[model samples]
Target: MANDFEVGVDVGVDPDAAWRLAGDPVAIRDWFGPVSDIAVDGDLRTVTMGNGAQLLERLVDRDDAARTYSYVVESGIPGLTSHRATIRVVEAPGGSRVLWRQTATSDVEGYDIEARLSGVMTAGLESLRDRLEGAAA
Candidate 1:
């Protein structure tokens, strides 16, 4: 089954500033708490999670003018057959809104993919909002 999740958070910073950090493929570790390290080679990215598990992803598309980037996970996650995610930063009323969206399919039986991924996305967005807002303060 395919699971879709989307999470967004508004931060007190300009969109460009948020994009400058969020749009960078290698800067995910700075905002996404679960990510401990990241290495990027061209369009490929290797992410090491806090638990030391790694995920390999391929950059699908990126648009600096739109402040958005998308990627597809290639390997390193058990049971995940397919996973594609996109992150975008847009101007909001007071600042900028960071939106994270994911579509994933898993072969694991009875696994609650939405619950798990949504939690991670929500927490990551909160962390991003804090980091960007703090830097602007």
Candidate 2:
């Protein structure tokens, strides 16, 4: 079984702007991490971060009308197995809401590493929300 966790952020941007920003892979990288010069070809995106952490991933599924996109990280920090995330954009009371749902389990480490990854996920999601809201503001 996979562990499931979800986080959401509401931005003042409308659904159309949110959808456009969220669905665009380059824009995603821009908001998500220490990403630099990111590029996407179809479902695949390659990003290089300043810290030298590289991300290579593939888009698993996307529903444009639904404003959702799913992806699997192919290789990022060994010993993590099947790291998958789903991001959805929705119409919220204030403007638009972005939700991130992630599923993953450690392949080689114990509880401490799991907790650490959870923190990383949380921080990243929060940063993403900040970036989106800042841009839309």
Candidate 3:
């Protein structure tokens, strides 16, 4: 856990539905403003976050039994270098819960900057929920 970036979203869709939408790379390019394409090669992936921010990371660990995937940043992004996000999906009272567990190391400045970056993940998750549940491109 290097830089912390966690956000939980409860979309109106079912858990399976949310997972389907979230795991689809094509659906990702649809809602994420900067993420042009998500190319996955083995455990490594390159996600182009808007504004020319290209993120390179690797799937170091995963618990298929738990339906959780953990990835670490290999390059790109600002501030902290190392990063990881483990998404957990569960059924909610009405729909589903998408919990994003992430972390990053603050560079030289401080953790406040890292905290702000957490908002970015939150916004992105919200965008995913809005776009998928609404089924609008």
Candidate 4:
């Protein structure tokens, strides 16, 4: 079965700033708390999570004009056959909104992959909002 999820958060920043922060690979650790280390080469990123898990991600597409980025997971995470995700930033009434979408296929038994991923995305987005808005304040 395939699991998909989309999560978003609004921050007190413009679309450009939000996009710039979110799109930077090195800046990921500042918001995504789980990422302990990030090594970027060209369009590929190797992320080491806090729990010692490592993941290889390939950048699939990036549209600066649209403030969107997409990537696919090449490895890591048990039972996951495939994973693709995208993050997009758009203008909102007070500031900007970032939306993260994930689609995955997992064959692991006794694990709620969707819920876990959803929680991670939610926390990450909220952390991003706090970091950007707090710095401005």
Q: Rate the local accuracy (lDDT) of all candidates.
A: 0.89, 0.74, 0.70, 0.88
RMSD of every prediction: 1.4, 2.9, 3.1, 1.6
* lDDT (Cα, 0-100) at 130 in candidate 3: 89
lDDT for each residue of candidate 3 in 1-137, tens digit (9 for 90 to 100)? 33555678888887777777665544567765667778888877888876667888787666544555677887886666566767777788778877777776657565553466567767878998887688733
Between prediction 1 and prediction 2, the one with superior lDDT is 1
Task: List the candidate 3 regions with Cα displacement exceeding 4 Å.
Answer: 1-5, 25-27, 78-81
Compose the digit string of candidate 4's lDDT tens values, residues 56-120: 99988888999988989999877888899999999998999999998887777755556787888
lDDT of 4: 0.88
Clash numbers, per candidate? 0, 0, 7, 0
Question: Could you tell me every candidate's TM-score relative to the true structure?
Answer: 0.93, 0.79, 0.79, 0.92
lDDT of 2: 0.74
> After TM-score superposition, what is the CA distance of residue 6 in candidate 1 from its true location, in Å?
0.3
Which parts of model 2 are misplaced by more than 4 Å? 111-114, 117-137
**Tens-place lDDT digits, model 2, residues 1-137:** 33677777777878878888777767766666656667788878887877888888898788899999888888865777778888888899978887778777666645234355556556665776677678766
lDDT of candidate 1 over 34-134, digit per residue (tens): 99999999899999999999999999889999999999999998888889999999999998999998888888886556777888889988988888888
Instruction: In model 3, state the lDDT of residue 4.
Output: 55
Ten contiguous residues with the weakest lDDT in model 3: 108-117
